[model samples]
Every structure is written in C-alpha cells, then in structure tokens.
Target: MNTIEIKKISKVFGSKTALNNINMSIKQGELFGLIGADGAGKSTLFDILVTLSAATSGSASVHGFDVEKDAKNIRRIVGYMPGRFSLYQDLTVYENLNFFASIFGGTIEDNYHLIKDIYEHIAPFKERPAGKLSGGMKQKLALCCALVHQPKVLFLDEPTTGVDPVSRKEFWGMLKRLQEKGITILVSTPYMDEAVLCERIALIQEGEIMAIDTPVAIIKSFTHPLYSVKSKKLYQLLKDLRNFKETYSCYAFGQTVHLALKNQDTTAIIIQDYLHGLGHENIEIKSIDAGIEDCFMELMKKTAE
Candidate 1:
C-alpha cells in the first residue's frame, strides 16, 4: 500500500513558494528520502504532510487518509521528528519519553516493546536533562519519543544534520532497525552520500522536485559522459575549461572539476594537447563514475533552464 501520496502539491507563502508543484508516492515499508540543501522546501512539504500546515493547492494522503479531510486520522498513524530537537530542554531523557507517551494516552511500559531497542542505548543517560546531553544523545532521545506512539509512517527531516560523523552512522543504523519493524520512513537530508541509504529519493532545489528514483538508477541516468579535470593551476584550469567549446558543463567537485562533455568527439587527446598549449602540463583529466550528487546538480541545471 502507498503509505504516503502527494499529487501536484504546491505551497506559497504570499509571493514566494516554499513548495511548488510537488508529486511523489511512498509505499509501505519503503525507506523514502527527500534530499536537498536547506531552503529546498523539504521541511515545508513535511509540515504539510504532518498537518502542521496546509497546502495552498494540490492533495496528499497518508495511509489512505486525506491530509486535508482526514488529518486527525493521519496524525494517529504518523510519527514526525522535525529538523530540530523539539523535546523539552529541562526534561530528563526518561521524562521526555514518558511525556510523549502520555500525550498519546500510553505509558512507557506500554510502548517499551516499540522503543526498547533504541532507548536501551540511552537508558544509562535516562536521568540526564535533554538540554545537557550531547547532540547525538539528544537525537536518540527525540527519536525514542517520536516512536513512543508506534506510528506506521515515520518522518525525519535532516535528523542527522549537526551530529558527529560516528553518531550519524549510528543513527542511520538505528533507522535501519526501525525499517525492519515495517514502518514507512520518509527522511530528508542535504547529505548526498546518504541518498544511497534510501530505497528511493526525490532531489529538490528551489522548492521544486528535480528527480525521483533509486540512488543507483539516478546515478545511472547521468548522460553526456563526465570527466574529472584537475591541475596545479586549479583555478585557471576551471576558468579555461568553462570556456572550452566542447565542455557542456563544469563545476568544482572536491579535488576535481566535473566536466559534462558537449559531444563524444572531444577526446582526451584533444583536451590534453589543448591544455598543454595553455602552459598547463601534468593535468589530470579522466572519465569518472558519476554519483548521486553529480546527477542532482545536472538535473538542477536542466530544471533552471
């Protein structure tokens, strides 16, 4: 079953759109990801789905319940963990968990089976006030509280942002565990690497959806061929490559500039002799396997045009 369905959803805050003409469907038990940098409208879309705000147009449903007409029913079956930690700062870990449980008309003991797996890791810190806990610790507590009600649809908006690298890995491991329990998860993150962890992802930019597919499929769809170009004079090389007639697109990606070729005729032999003539020797330019980020940037450029 489709746990979440959105059709042509658009949200405008007066003159600007926070979410524009978005459409996506997430099936039950699927780990769906909404990936983009901040201000990409991920949070706005999440807020609308969770009933924290209303869409200016279009429609959405969660677990077959319409977000507009049956929002109350949807709330009962959806768990939301916003981008920021929303737990009471003064509340101890245990108290915060218990408080959420009460709000759902249940007790920690009643939901122990649902959260014990994750909660146990922080059980020793149960008495620590949430405000005093480290960022990673706070993440775990927020997740535990969100799961206290055992909702079927889970929403996480950049849950790993601002956390340590080790903690980020551990948190994803926890998410995998939750997936085993058969909950449909919708997580949003700007981290391109994390796109591989989801069953499918929708890349967004400027409040618009760019591409939606499995990470592998998205990476595979990158056409026109790509090459990593680098040299001692990186800055000059970047400028020259952009002006190269054969270069379709060029952007600095880490240690190299990713080049999208304008045509297949521009061979490495041609590029090499051209750069060599420009006083740039020992240049590194070779075909490189494209990744999710590469595909996303390319798609964003296409969308803008």
Candidate 2:
C-alpha cells in the first residue's frame, strides 16, 4: 500500500511558486527521499504533506488521510522532524523528550522500545540543556522525540544538514533500523551521497521533480560517456574544458573535473593530448562510472532545455 500520495500539488507564495505541480506516491515501509539543494521547495512540500501548511492547489494524503480535511488524523499518524532544531533550547534533554511525548499523550516508557537505541545515547546527558548539546546529540534527541509517539510515517526534512559526517552516517544507520521495524520514511536531503542511502529518491530542482527511481537505476540511466579529468591548473582546466568544441558537460568533482565529451569519438589520450597542447601540464583523463550527482546534473540540464 502507498503510505503517501500527492497529485499535481503546487504551492505559491505571493509572486513565487514554491512547488510546481508535483506528483509522487510513496509506498509503505519505503525509505523515499526528496533529493535537492535548499530553496528547491523541499520544505514547502514537507509542510504541505505534514498538514502544517495547505497547498495552493491539487491534493496530498498521508496514510489515506487527506492533508486538508483529515489533517488531524494525518498529524496523529506521522512523525515529523523539521530541518531546523525546533525543540525547546532552554529545556533539558529529558524535558524536551517528555514534552513531545506528553503532547501526543505518550510517555517515553510507552514507546521506549521504539527509540531505545537512540535515546540511550542522549540519556547520559538528560540533565543538560538542549542548547548545550553538540549537533549530533541534538539530532538524536530530536529523533527520539519524533519517534516517541511511534507514528507509522516518519518525515525528516534535511535531518543531517549541519551535523558532523560521523553523526550523519550513524543517523542513516538509525533510519535503516527504523525501516526494518516497518516505519515509512520520507526524508529530504541536499547531500547527493545521502540520496544513495534511500531505497528510492525523487530529484527535485527549482520546485520540480527531475526524476524518481532507485539510486542505481538513476545512475544507470546516464547515457553519456563520462570521464574524470584533472590538471595542475584546475580552475583554468575547467574554463578550457567548457570552451572545448567537443565538450558536452564539464563540472568539478572534488579533486577531478568530470568531463562528458560531445561524442565518444575522442579517446582519453587524445583529450589529454588536446589539453597538453593548450599548455595544461600533468593532465589526466580517464573513463569513470556515473553516480547520483552525475545523473542529477544530467537531469537538470535536460529539464532546463
């Protein structure tokens, strides 16, 4: 069964469209992701789905409950952790947990089993003010609070945005554990690497969904022959590659710039020779596998055209 359904949903604020006729159906127990950078309407879409804000047009439902008329029922069945830390900063860790639990008429003990693994890490600092905890600890506490009610659907909006890498990894681990226990998660993240952790992801750009599929499938759909190219003059190499007549796409990828030739007609050595001719020394160009970011870039280019 699909846990959430959205149809031609759009949200406009005064002069700008935050969401543009978005459509998606998320399956039960699925770890689905809305992958995009900030201002891509991820938060707006989440607000609409969680019934915190109404859509300007079209419809959305969570667990068969309409986001408009049946909002109260939707709220009861969904656990939402917004991108920001909205918990009371002045309250102690334990107080925040207790407060959220009490709001849903649940005691921490009532849902202790659901969040035991996460809560235990923060329990040692239960007496500390929430504001005093590190980024990772704050994340764990927020998650524990969100799960205390044991909601069937979990909505996390960029949960790991500013957290440390280690905490981000550990948080994904916790998500996997939650999925194992049958909770449907709809998470959004600006991190391309994080998108691969989801069972399926929808790549959103400028309030529109560029593509929706499993991570592997999306990467496999990349049709261009891609190459990782590097040179001593990294910045100049990027400009030169963009100006290359045969260059289809060229973008920096960490230490190397990914180059997609207009045609597979030129070999890596030929491209390297070409760069060498242009005064670029110590140049390296090699074929490489495409990842989620590559696919997203391709999709965005396609959509822009």
Candidate 3:
C-alpha cells in the first residue's frame, strides 16, 4: 500500500512558491529519498506531510489519513527528525530519549529493542550533555529518540548533512535495519550518492520534482555519451571545453571535467587532441558511465531549457 501520497500539492510563502504541484507516492517499507539542494523545499514538504504545516493548495495524506483533516492522528504515527538539531541541548543523552518516550506514552525499556543498536553507540556517553557531544554522536542520539515510540513512519530531513562519512554509512545501515522491521522512511538529502542508496528517489529543485525513479532506471535514461577529461590546466580546460562548439555540457566532477558532447561524430581523441593544441599537457579524456548526479544534471539542464 502507499504509505504516503501527495497530489497537486503546492505551498506558497507570499511571493515565493515553495512547492509547485508536487506529486509522488511512497510504498510501505520503502526507503524513499527526496533529493535536492538547500532551499529546494524538501523541508517544507516534510512539514506538511507530518502535519507541522499546512499546504497552500492541493492535498496530501499519510496512511490514507488526510493531512489537513486528520493531522492529529497522522502525528501519532509519524516521527520527524528535522534537518536542524532540535534535541534539548542542556539535557543529558539519557534524559532526552526518556523525555521523548514519555510524550508518546512509552518508556525507554519499552522500545529498547527498536533503538538498541543505535542507542548502544551513544550509551557510552549517556551522561554527557547533548550539546557537548560530537556531530556523529548527537545524530545517533537524535535518531534513538525519534524511534523511541516505534512510529510506523519516519521522516528524516537531511539526517546526515553534517555527519562524517563513516557515520553516514553506519546510519544508512541502521535505516536498512529499520526498513526490515517495516518502518516507512521518507528521507531528504542533497547528496546525490545517498539518493542511489534509496529504493526510489524524487529529485527536487526549486520546490519541484524533476524526476522520480529508481537510481538505476534514471541513469539508464541518460542518452548522451559522457566523458571525463582532465589535464594539468584543469580550469583552463573547463573554460575551453565550455566554449567548444561540439560540447553539449561541461562541468567539474572531482579532479576531472565531465563533458557531454553535442553529437557522437567527434570522438574523445578529437577532443583530447584539440586540448593538446591549446597547450594543455597530460590531457586525458575518455567515455565514462553516467551516475545519478549525471542524470540529475541532465534533468536540470532540460528543465532550464
């Protein structure tokens, strides 16, 4: 069943449109991702679905309960962990978890099994004030508190935004475990790599979903040939490639520039030779597989067109 549904949903803040006719559905036990950069309206959509805010128009529901009409009931079954750290900083780790549990009529012991794996990582610092904890540790504690009540649906907005790579990987592992327990998760992240980890992702930009599909399917839809070109003069190469008539698009990707050619007639060797003529040494250009980020960039380009 669709655990969450949105149709023609739009949110406006006076002159700005936060969400424009957004539509998507998430199935039960699905780890769905809302991929977008900051100010892309991911947080706004989360607020509406969790009953924290009202939409300007259209409709949304969680578990078949209307977000506007049955907001109170929806709140009871959903756990929201906002992008910003909202836990009580002055309180100890143990106190914060217990406090949230009390609100849901649950004790730490009652839901220990649900969050034990995550809580154990933070238990060593249980007596530490939340404000004193490291970014990773605080993230663990916040997640534990969110799961304390065993809510059926969990909303995590950029949960790993400031977290370290190791902690981010560990957190995704914890999420996989939760999905195994049948908890529906709607997570938002700006990291394109993280979007690939979700079963399905909805790429949003400026409050609009550009594409919705599995990461693999999205990548497969990329029809253009992509190449990774690098040389000693990287910046100059980037500028030169952008001005090249045959270059469809050129953007930096790590140490190299990902260039999409306008047509297949010009080969990589031709581009490399052209750069070589421009006094660029150690030039390297070759076709590379497209990833989720590549697909996102392609979609964004199309949207701009």
Model 1: CA > 4 A from native: none
**Candidate 2 backbone collisions, by pair:** none
TM agreement with the true structure for every prediction: 0.95, 0.97, 0.98
- Per-residue CA lDDT of model 1 for 1-305, tens digit only, reads 57899999999998999998999999989999999999999999999999989999999999999999998998888888999989999999999998999888888898788788789889999998999999888888889988999899999989999987898988898899899999899999999988999999999999998889999999999987888988888888889888888988988987788989988888887888878888986798899889888898889889888
lDDT of each: 0.90, 0.93, 0.93
Per-residue lDDT of 243 in model 2: 87
Which of the two candidates, 1 or 2, achieves a greater lDDT against the reference?
A: 2
Supply every candidate's count of residue pairs whose N, Cα or C atoms clash at under 3 angstroms: 0, 0, 0
User: What TM-score does structure 2 among the candidates reach?
Assistant: 0.97
Q: Residue-wise lDDT of candidate 3 within 212-298, one digit each (tens)? A: 999889898987889999999889999999988899898999899999988889898889778888899998878998999998999
Question: What lDDT would candidate 1 get against the real structure?
Answer: 0.90
- Determine which window of 10 residues in candidate 3 has minimal summed lDDT: 268-277
User: Any residue pairs clashing in model 1, and if so which?
Assistant: none
